[model samples]
Structure formats: structure tokens, C-alpha cells
Target chain A: TQLLEQSPQFLSIQEGENLTVYCNSSSVFSSLQWYRQEPGEGPVLLVTVVTGGEVKKLKRLTFQFGDARKDSSLHITAAQPGDTGLYLCAGVVLQGGSEKLVFGKGTKLTVNP
Target chain B: DAMVIQNPRYQVTQFGKPVTLSCSQTLNHNVMYWYQQKSSQAPKLLFHYYDKDFNNEADTPDNFQSRRPNTSFCFLDIRSPGLGDAAMYLCATSREKRTGGTDTQYFGPGTRLTVL
Candidate 1:
């Protein structure tokens, strides 16, 4: 079983539509980071939410950390075709500098123009 | 522009052949990490280097080895490439924080490997 699970394994929508992706976990995390990876590339960090109940915004993208720090949510308003990619939420395990990150299955979003 | 860079965007190796993937960072971060990602799955951490200390994940196979020769460069070596080893290899770097697990990692574009 994956420590982190993302909902809506796949999403396809028209341009300018809004959507939300969720990452849920039973285990608590020190910090959770969201990433967007395109085909043939690595996951790129979008934002990081450390504190429980923290909410961060990057332009039209908003990220919220659960009050328990065990979950996170990403909401996109008027998502564009450029936003099409795999969205992954990753968090570092309690272990030391091994820097091992537990990743969610991912939500693949395809925005059509 | 200081960022992580990966060499050989695409690598094709025969089965049982040795392969190496290179990653470099200009960010000057104190930590470097190597991850193997198969199709439609999450990136699995293989190992990492903090300064000169190497840490390997418990589940990482012995077939995989890594080297951090200096601050700016890191290498991932596969003793023998197998069909299962065909995947995207990602390199990430971060600065060590006193807070430990809260550091945000910056990732490279990645190297795609194909074992034939």
C-alpha cells in the first residue's frame, strides 16, 4: 500500500476549466511538496507546504496542507493546456538525510485546448 | 542559471551491460539524491549523498551504486543492466537543513534508460 494516495488517477478536461487534486495519507509528514512532471522529464517542485493547515498560492494554483499534515490538496483555476502533466505529491520520511521521499501514485491531467 | 543537470538524456544499453548516468548541480546544495522511476509509478529513492557521507535506502538493490566525487557532480552506476532497469533516472539536490526533513529538493530533467 502506498503511504501517499492521490485521487482521480486521471483527469481530462477542456481548457479554462478548474480542477482539484488530492493527496491523502495516514502517516504524518514534516513537509509536503507538489510537483508537475511532463512526459520524458523529471518531477519539478511546484510548492511546499510545511505547517499543518498551511495554504500557499502560486498564481492560479493553490495548495493546502491538512490540519494533521497527513494530507494535501491542489486546486487549479482556469487550468490551461500547458498545465497538462502528471501531478505528484511527495514528502520526506521521518528518517534522516537519506532524503527518501514517499510519493503518491499521481494524478495525470490532460487539458485540451 | 544554477540548476541540476543530467547527462545522456537517453541511454540505451544491452542486457547485462554496465551503464552509468551522471547528474550535476550548480545550486551548490549540500545533498544529492538518485531515484529510479518505472513507468506509471512514483520515483523510488535509491540513495543519496550529504557532503561526503553516502546513504543507501534499505530496499535499493546491490546492482545499483552511486558516487558523489565532488560538490557539483554525482553518478549512478548499474553493474548490469536488466530489462527491469529501463526507466527514467532522476537526480535531485537540496541544502541540508537543521530542521531535517523539511528541505525542498530541486530535480533535474532526468535520464531515460532503455535496456535491450
Candidate 2:
């Protein structure tokens, strides 16, 4: 089974502070996706990085995929309380016409105002 | 807007009772999935249907079952609910990408199940 290990399982920072979360794996994936889930809600996709060494930014958030396709990272600049939530990284592996995603335990972020 | 929808945002069931959760989609995707997520944990895929084909994960418990009666709907049935079965059940849908690899999965708000 493919496993993803996320670092710093918990994070607490003040508003306007910067922080980064990392997801790493020993196996390669066809694509990697980032999702943010708030309490009482399902996870919402943030972005997907398919290419190696690719970087995509969503306003203050920047997401990067490793060149080897074995890791990914999410960087937030000037974080706000709205960013407080659980961040999950899922690595997608395609099997035949179907696929499965292996998710990390997730990083819980608490942004205090 | 096309999206996934789940019924009964919350459900309460007694131990050993059977409970069913429903999911529907407007996207007409060919694939629908059921996942179980415990508090502060990652979501675990229970099973999924590709068109009419049902696929179950190897480690999934036998008490868990799923049905996709048609293209637009899917159901998750948990037999003999236990305290361990109490968790958020999420339904997701995705269309098979013509370009290959995995297609983007759209998720529903999920149904939080409480076992008493």
C-alpha cells in the first residue's frame, strides 16, 4: 500500500504569520492534490499538481510538487484566521481505468487572530 | 452547478442497528465512491462503483456494503453499527478522464453518523 507521511501534524500560528506544510512519500504518484476541510464540512480541493516540479498559487497559498513525484508542499503567506482548517494531501495512483488516492493523516492549522 | 449531494447531514443509530446513507450527483460522473472518516483522521475509501461495477477495498469490513442503483445515485449500508462505526461518511463522484490518470473527485458535505 502507498503511504503518505505529513510533517508537523499540528500547527498554530498568529494571523498574518507564514507557515508551510509538507507531504512526503517513498512511492511515486501520477498526481498529487491538496484539500482543506473545516469542521462539519467535507474536504474541498485546493489544487492538483500533476507535473514534476510544478508550482501553483492560489492567492496567498502556494503549492509545489516534487520533481520525483514523491512529495509535495503547501506554503501560506500572510495567513488569516480563515485559513484555519485541516490540510490533507492525497497521492493518486491510476490502476487500469480506475484510480485510488492515498491520503496523509493531515496537518491541522489553527490561526489565532 | 454540478456537484455531489448527500442526504441527512447527520444520523443517529443504535448499536447493532443497520443504517443506510445516500448520495446523489448532478455531474453524471461514471464513478461514485464511499469513504469513512473518523474525527481528526484521513478519509478511508470503503468502496466505489465504476459505472455498474462495484469494487471493494481489501481491508474493508464485511459489515459495510454499497449499492449504485443507477448512474445518479449510490448508497452505503452499514450492518450492525458499532461504536467504531461512528464517523463521517463522505460520498464522492468523478468522471473517467479521457486523458488517463485519475480524474478530479468532487465531494459531498458528508453525513455525520452517531452511534448510541
Candidate 3:
């Protein structure tokens, strides 16, 4: 079975601090996506990276896909309390002729003021 | 705006009681999915509908079933709600299925199920 492993399962940092979350996998994916989920709510898509070494920025959030398509990362330049939530990385994999997402365990981030 | 919606926001059921969770979408997308998310965990896809065709995940429990009676709505039925079944249920939709995960899925707020 293909699996995505996320590092720093829990992170707590002060406002204006920077942090990075890692998502690694042994299996190559066709694409990777990052999602942020607040408590009591479903996840919201932050960005999707399709190419190896691809990087996308959404405000202070930066997402990068590995050149091997086997890993990804999310970096926050200056996190605020509003950024506190769960960060999940999901990879698109073809299974039984159909494509589906395999998600990482996720990193729970708490940006304290 | 066109979006996915889930009912109740929160649901409570007795152990072994049957319950059905509802999902509706105004986006008129061709695909709808059901995901189970436990606290501090990633959303796990349970099943999905591509138009009228049903696709079940290999590991989804037999106690769980789903129905898409029409284009705008889908339902998830838990035959015997176990304590382990307590989790947030999310419904998402995509316009169409694409290779390499190009299809973007919009998610609803989710329904949190509590089993006692």
C-alpha cells in the first residue's frame, strides 16, 4: 500500500514565527495537493502542485512539490493565529484504473498570539 | 454560489441504531464523494459516485452504504452505528474525473457524528 508520512505531527509557534511541514512518500504521485482544515469544518484546498519541483504561493503560504514527485512541503513565512489548523497533504494515485487521493496523517499547527 | 452542503452540522445516534447522513450540491458536478475524518486525522475516502455509477473503496466496512438517488444529492447510511463510527463526515464534489488529480473538489462543512 502507498503511504504518505507527515513530519512534526504537532507544532506550536508564536505569531510571526516561521515553520515548515513535510510530507514524504516512497510511492510517486501524479500530483500533490495541500489543504488546511479548521476545527469543526471540512478541509479547504490551499493549492495543487502538478509538476516536479513546482512551487506555488498563496499569500504567506508557500508549497513545493519534490522533483521525484515523492514528497512535498509547506512553509509559512509569518504565521498568525488565524493560520492555526491542520495541514494535510494529499497525493493523487491511480488505483484499479481510477484516480484517488491518498492523504498524509497531517500536521496540527497552533499559531499562538 | 454553487457549492456542496451537508445537513445537520452535527448528529447524535445510539449505538447500533441506523442513521443516514445527507449531502447536496448546487454545483451540479458529475462526481460526489463521502469521507470519514476522525479527530486530528486526514479525511479518508469511503466511497463516491461518478454520475450514477457507484464506486466503493476496498476497505470500507460493509456496515456502511451509500446512495445517490439523483444528480443533486447523495446519502450515507450506517447500518449499525458503532462507537468507532463517531467522526466527521465530509461531502465533496468535482466537475469531472481527471487523470493526475487535476479535478478540483469542493467540500462541504461536514457533519460531525456522535455515537453513544
Candidate 4:
């Protein structure tokens, strides 16, 4: 089973539309992070949400951490073509007294012009 | 700009051949990590170094090896490349071990490996 599960494996939408991607898990995480990866490149850190029930906004993108720290959501307002990419969510999980970073399969977002 | 850099953006090797991928970071972070990412999948952790202290994942194949001679550079060695080993290899670095998820990891463009 995947430690983190991201919904809508793929998303295609028209420009200026709004959409949200979700990452869910059964285990609690100390921290959760969202990353955006462009084609032929590595993933880039978009935001990190640590505190439960916390909300952060970056430009048109908003990220929220679940109150239980087991889930996270990313919302994009008026998505543009430039926002097309793979959205990955990662979390820090403690196992055997050590912390490990786990990643979800990721949601491939495509915005049409 | 201080950043992570990977060499040989693309690599092609014959089956059973050995290949090496190099990563260097100017950020001088103490933690460097190597990840394997296949198409339409999440990046999988292969191994990492915390200032010469190597940490390998339990499932990482024996064919994979790594070396960190210094803080700025790390190398991933594939002892015997197979078709299944073909994937994008990503190198990343962070200021320290993530405790609160505040330490952001910086990644390189990645090296695409092809095994025939």
C-alpha cells in the first residue's frame, strides 16, 4: 500500500478554471509538503505545511494541512497553462525511531489553452 | 546561485554494463539523496548520505551503490545495468535531516538512464 495516496491521477482542464488535488493517508505525518514538477525536470518544492489545520497561500495556489496530519489539499485558483505539471505530495513519517520521507504517485495536471 | 547539479543529463548503456551518475551541490548541505523515478510514478528513495554516513533503503537492490567523498559531491554507481534499471535518477540536498519538514530539499534536473 502506498504511504500517501493522491486523487485524480490525471487532470485536464481549460485555462482559467479552478481545481483541487488531494493527498490522503491512514498514518499521521509530522509534516507535509507539496511539490510541482515540470516535464524533463525534477520536482520543485511548492509549499510545506506542518501545523495541523494550517492554511497557507502562495499567489493563486493555496495549501492546507489536515487537522489530524494525515492528509493535505492543494487548490489552484484560475489555473493557467503554465501551471500544468505533476503535483506530488510528500510527508515525513517516523518509523523505528527514524524519519522517512514518502511520496505519493502524483497528479498530472494539464491545462489547455 | 547555490544549487544542485547533475552530470550527463542522459546516459545510454548496454545490458550488464556499469554506469555512474554524479551529483554536486554548491549549497554545501549536509544531507544528499538519490532517488529513482520511473514514468508516471513517484520518485523512490534509493539512498542518501549524511556527511559520509551512508544510509541505504532496505529494498534497494544490491546492484546499486553510492559514494560520497566530500560534502559537495556524491555518486551513484550501478554495478550491472538492466532494462529494469532504466529510469530518471534525481539528486537532491537539504540543509539537515528533516525534523519538522521545514528543511526544503533542492533537486537537480535529473539524469535519464537507458539500458539496452
Chain A only TM-scores, each candidate in turn: 0.95, 0.98, 0.97, 0.94
Model 4: residues >4 Å from true position, as ranges?
Answer: A95-98, B99-101
Tens-place lDDT per residue, model 3, B30-109, is 89999999887778999999999999998999999999999999999999999999999999998887744578888999
Q: Which stretch of 10 consecutive residues in model 2 chain B shows the poorest summed lDDT?
A: B95-104
User: Which tens-of-lDDT digit does each residue in A1-113 have in candidate 4?
Assistant: 44899999999999999999999999888899999999889899999899999999999999999999999999999999999999999997665544567999999999999
Candidates, DockQ: 0.64, 0.64, 0.72, 0.69
- Provide the lowest-lDDT 10-residue window in model 1 chain B: B96-105
The local lDDT score (0 to 100) that residue B23 gets in candidate 2 is 98
TM-score of 1: 0.95
Candidate 2 lDDT at B87 equals 97
Could you estimate the TM-score for every candidate? 0.95, 0.96, 0.97, 0.96
Winning model by TM-score: 3
Worst ten-residue run, lDDT, model 2 chain A? A93-102
Comparison by lDDT, 1 against 4, better one: 4
lDDT (tens digit, per residue) of candidate 2 on B65-99: 99999999999999899999999999988886334
Give the C-alpha lDDT of model 2: 0.92
Reference-based lDDT, each prediction: 0.90, 0.92, 0.92, 0.92
Clash list (residue pairs), candidate 1: none
Please provide, for model 2 over A1-113, each residue's C-alpha lDDT reduced to its tens digit, 9 standing for 90 to 100. Answer: 89999988999999999999999999999999999998888889999999999999999999999999999999999999999999999999876656888889899999999
